[model samples]
Target: MICALTGVFPVTQARAQQAPLPEGARIVVPGHGWGHGRGMGQWGAKGLADQGKTYTQILSTYYPGTTLGARASTEDIRVLLETSSDVIASSDQPFTARWSNNSIIATSDATYRYFKETWDGTNYHGGSIHVYRGAIEAHQGGSSINSINVLTMQQYLYGVVPRESPASWPAEELKAQAVAARTYAARRKDSSRAAGSSYDICVTTSCQSYGGYGTKSSPTSSVTVLESSSTNSALDATAGKVLMYNGSPILAEYSSSTGGYTAASSLPYQKAVPDPTDSVSPHHDWTASMTVSEIEARWPSIGRLIDLTVTQRNGYGGWGGRVLQMNIIGTKGTTTLTGYGFMNAFAWPGRSNGLQGNWFTPLYWRGVLQSAPSAVTMYAGESKTISVRITNTGTASWPVGGNVHLATNSASSFATSTWISSTRPASVARNATDPTKSSVGPGQVAEFHVPLSAANMPPGNYSQRFALIADNQSVTSLAFTVGIQVLVPWVSEAPNLLTNASFEPSTYAWR
Candidate 1:
């Protein structure tokens, strides 16, 4: 749940009115899940494995309607290792460097040097050298150059699987990871080439974590090399295997965890699904808080802070649902932010360590009566237009069909028709243009106007309340009250016809 960290106030309205939020009130938000909440959840897979589910079952659950398919192993993939003007190419044993222009260049044993252009094939210490297959191309980047490794798809998976999922994980889980990573890599290979890049994918998180040769060395450093036997075995087991949908390699997107339910996506395979095992993940649930001042600092247009509400959600059906849209309400105006935008807004330091995922509950007041009709005295049988400005200060959007009407109180002294009885109920309309028709979204205000007629009212003062209604239910928290005084039109005594005549004792006695 997301809670605004504004200053505390009394529980009762009267006391809350006496103690207002101090200057610079804050908003605190807490949330759940992690990553993009898409595709195969690593932790969920682990959970399934722990529950004795096979790798095939786990894959089928995450990637619905996908089938295991075989692809040609002949197609090679290009991976961008490093980008720099100078690249150190070395090997333990002497190797031949064949240039792109069909030039043969021999390298000294155990030495690193820079090469200007492309090479036909650089073989080092047999297959002991873990650079890449095919040829290594040194493409010129802006003011520098990039070192690309063109190799078979299988060789690329050897560097990717271990980094994406732990090599020590269950053999089935590792196999699942290998297949998914392979499928993902294959789909991106062609697209990357079409984009006019030297490599099919990068050796970073932008594509997938790829550590060449030894898994022990970092992507940035080319040091000691180490390989995990388990990961290598998984790669061999799933060689040339990929997840395919409609006879094509699917975009197999995977994340660390999905909390409990996967996110909704346009892809049919990425639909929302419940994973009971995701709870075992560390980032299954998390929370963060921030001040109103901090949020306002990021989005000053929100003006004086009021409340936050969730306007729309995806079809995932999780708590707070996967936030699709949100409304940030302030005294000056309201700002509508998409779920992703709202998460980015609180990405500031000490605000919310950033929203883990779009799934989170917005915990705050739903609406506020910013302006209400003042107490007025009107003659019995007269009419007055009573209007109130109500702002949607919650996390949810107020749809077009929602309504706002007077509250019911059978014990009230005043009769129901004493005020406005004709417009018994009113719908929440757009704050601007055609309030009677348009809908009031989150952070937006709706003005409810009712023509109050004192038709059969007695000479007395009365107080009435109104509330916002949605789904045929009254939003009691948003209810507001208005005051009215009805008076008789005439007095019993008649006025004397003596014009401009004054009587004694400073009292105007007319005769």
Candidate 2:
């Protein structure tokens, strides 16, 4: 298996050196690991091999309960090399190919530019071959042709192991891959072809990849042939070994990398485990960026994207396991999708932004629904209670901890004597009538009644800015600016307050 899906999806958000996506900024995902996070991690195997672990140790670490044993038989395996097309192929030396029409073409030293021709329906499994110890067979389907490579297990692996793993990796790593690949291949009832198809596996990521013989890549000089010497030697060393469970070969699955930890799997043997060595993999850490427009474009029913939140995780490795399901919040409606469903929807090939794996936390754009007294005249040295209603719009709940409060921005010089500091004005306060409203969750509203006074400074026309703060971080989209008129105290009368955002010209008498 080139990529096997493990438990689910999940994420732990990061910031600072890796900053959070600003509200309404293009959505960016800081992610960890790659693949489905199942079974043996190839890069991890290499790292462990470099650390002096043997092939058996690497296998044991990944497939915990499986036993290593020799294969029951070394039957030939069929690999689907090309599908739905005309196949033109030849070998290094003398080789013969039988078409579906029972026609035979024999050639020698052909450069393998390939002799392309239309298909005639007669399938041949056993033909003649001297190159790579394999033969090419073409099958006729309803409307398309499927080209398959027929070869013995050893010859099959010669073209397989190197494509699945790096040919230059340490001997133990290559050997471990070879064994895993062999077991996986042996367990293949068939490739994703319809039942009773002619092939056992495929040369795509859908299955283990294969570099077919008779290509420029699979060159032969009568002395050396194809990809890697180290990988071939590893194949030879681990000849018929397979990972067996209950005395039968287990469907050994392996992926490129598992970030820091492997994800859980439905199969008991493919358990979640720490992969400390996989830091060497390039995909161990990654970040993918997609825009709000792109998301709404793909999932149009989700009108304007408001929030992308991962709800449940598998509870295994990184990101609190893997993401199981997520809610896509939008102005028009909401849509829930599994991790794979979301990835398949938003990210894909042929696009610049492709979400590599499901192991990620999506940080989205957010803005507050603020309802506050905008136009106001305050008496200097006199404080009055004002109400500001804040609707929680982000994915997280707004806690009432003193850490989450209303604060002044750095540029604000209109400080009032009642403020906690030059920066902080007041903490999130509850409605006295509703004492149970301790914290504000998503979509809920919280009321802030803070003392906004025109005090301790020269009273003049002033512009001031304040922001909703959480744990010392300013919520940028929640920041709002206001203009105020500060007059000298006038007979202790209450100041004029307006509910709407528009400010009106004030003609007031000063004491």
Candidate 3:
């Protein structure tokens, strides 16, 4: 197949003949949304709250068909705060600690240690000995250290609400967050991400950011005044309430932003929905620019990357869907991977960051900016022009900053004398928008006005292909074709060399 580019011959080949990706091509992937778009978008919540929507209204919008559920009175949860050898526990008020029926009392100055002989999941539950509010338990689990914070769901959320969502946000927003955090904690079952770890949920993104009872992080006491009054009030406003789907707390996953649309989940309530107010988020729309060379470096097995083809998407909003499966084609071989797998590959040495989300589209470098006339018709000596557009897709812009030309091929018979060579037509015209630009730059589209003349050719039909060239090397082989029907010049005025000069003319001339 005649692979992509401009030349003298008509590019009669099918679209499959488009050239392979330039090895050093630059690609810009414009994307929408930020995180793993499942569940509610935190920014959307803040925006809704600011618009006078109640927390219940915001929650119902995100988690469709979910209602507030009742929680057990004085429910408690365990949050993994830290991991260290020396476990320390202190409290301003005298608190009691017991392990295996052995109890000890300690006040603020004189601290006491609670050692769990075995984490039977029930032996040491809460540090609340009269007022263990300022207590953090550092226990030993199988030769490793794990500092667990045991507190009532309400108080724990008092610390978590402000940390997950900024404490300075609106009251309704914080209340929504408080309810989400509470639901997330109440429904927690297993969060064993590491060996010898025995905690219901660790205070990290894996579960959610929980700021013990005091500070933003662990190894700190639950200082009441240290907590945000705003967050505490928000928690109080939405006390003992969790999102219920089917008689249980629904998994109310949340992230910093959802771009525009929340991702769908297996859960019935976590369906993909539009988040219009999410525009308040900085990550709502984003772009990631890169080169094909870096892609090759990431997947050495693929040699040089030839192309990236997204095969399947989830079929939702913005770009129609999120990439589900794609093919990474290269010189050595082709690798098929799911959308997440492709993202994981970007974590290699060169790629600065992974793609924000699967919802992205590699955008236009150059293409048929304006289509050439569907047909061309002209008489002898008449001129018809075609526009060719090009962009800097490879190592350098057209002509390598020298001068790029939209030229004809060696065999094209339609080449006019004005052509640079029998094949080369003219410098690719200036930027489509600016006339002064002489060469196409990166991400810029330059036009070329190819003058087709019919003066020298016989009138049947003609076809020629054009391509972009710079520095004597082929910039793009993806040629465009122009077909013209050159008819004989129409007769307007004609002179006749009359034989007898209208009969009397010969006699008069002879006289």
Candidate 4:
């Protein structure tokens, strides 16, 4: 992922080293690891192989206590090649296809053929190309559909292993990856049915990366045939082997790197283990620096972020620990987020400023509440409007509609009827220069207002308790007094010590 940075921050090292950042400036954060940090670490596997570990040893270390067994390769698997309204099905040599009308047509050595529904054909080597099982629907360009390849599990791995891991890696590592990929694909053989398609898996990273037939036209055609030959050897060597526990294939998930330690896994076979070999990976440890203002732009509801802390961690706790929960303390309130939640809060696909993995150090400024409305006094059945100005001292943006709101608390004395004309108990809007703008960026003020009333209330002081609502949840509470004074009716008469001083027609007198 790439990030764009601008503004007055120094560019030259000499200038940056000479001057300190202005007080309250945002700090830079460094991060480590990559991917989800789950299952087999490809770099870690390579490290283990370099140390002369065999394929079985590597697999045993990653997926502990699993047995290697063979399954029949007769079961065919479907792999989605591309999604288009129309697809061209071809082979290196002449092939025959069966159409939807149950008609078999033999082609005169055509490189490709267009089809809509089912079209079953064969390659020069007698391998079958099945395009019949998925939707024949088109998106975008119109009149296009997706193409699928039907082949044995073994043949699918021939294209997958090379695309996922480098073909030049040690043979033992390649074999381990081949088995892992095969097992991963085998377990999801029924996925196509659930997805209402004919193919069981896709050709993207969402599934195992697959490029069919080692051809330039393959989805991942960048890989050369020579490079694929090495991985092909690994697939042949492993044949139908898969790591099994209790007579079933394990999930067999894998990623690029695990930094120094694997993530704690719930599955007994996918346990955490030290991967010192993965140190060779460039992303094993990395640093990312962003201004506090930049981070605040993402989470404005937290207010001016004063501090960020890891409140919880998985069983693995340390420099490489996986954060289970985090708390963002701002001037307005503290926001708690889960590990995955924290990732999504900042990192989006194709966007930068996100951690590579859950492991990282955070440095930020605390958010602050700058101002609040004063206590209001109103007669019973009267209304008074109030506003509170809050400053986001933290590193997240206060979003317009969802993250910033005024919510009455349980201890609030006023009933829903006390709010002047609104149906909801509380009404909130963003503090924008133009009423139409929605968000309050970092270092900006969010002004919340509502018409408070004292209708149908006894004559006494009551605390109208409220809290700031962010991300559709309440973060903290505040309160102000609303004194609902009695409406004393009086009559003008000769001064008596406790008598009303003036009245035209008094409805009631002070008791």
TM-score versus the correct structure, for each prediction: 0.61, 0.67, 0.64, 0.57
User: How does each model score on lDDT?
Assistant: 0.68, 0.70, 0.67, 0.63
| Alpha-carbon RMSD of each model | 15.4, 11.3, 13.1, 19.4
Higher TM-score: candidate 2 or 3? 2
Stretches of model 1 off by over 4 angstroms after superposition: 1-24, 96-99, 104-135, 194-196, 215-223, 347-352, 364-511
Give me the candidate number with maximum TM-score.
2
Model 1 root-mean-square deviation: 15.4
| Ranking of all predicted structures according to TM-score, beginning with the best and ending with the worst | 2, 3, 1, 4
Collision count of model 1 = 19
Cα distance off (Å), candidate 4, residue 365: 7.7
For model 4, how does the per-residue alpha-carbon lDDT over 267-295 read when each residue is reduced to its tens digit? 87877777788898877877555555554
Better of 1 and 3 by lDDT: 1
Point out the higher-scoring one by lDDT: 2 or 3. Answer: 2
Q: Which candidate number has the best lDDT? A: 2
Supply candidate 2's per-residue lDDT for 366: 37
Q: Is candidate 2 or candidate 4 better by TM-score?
A: 2
1 against 4, candidate with superior lDDT: 1
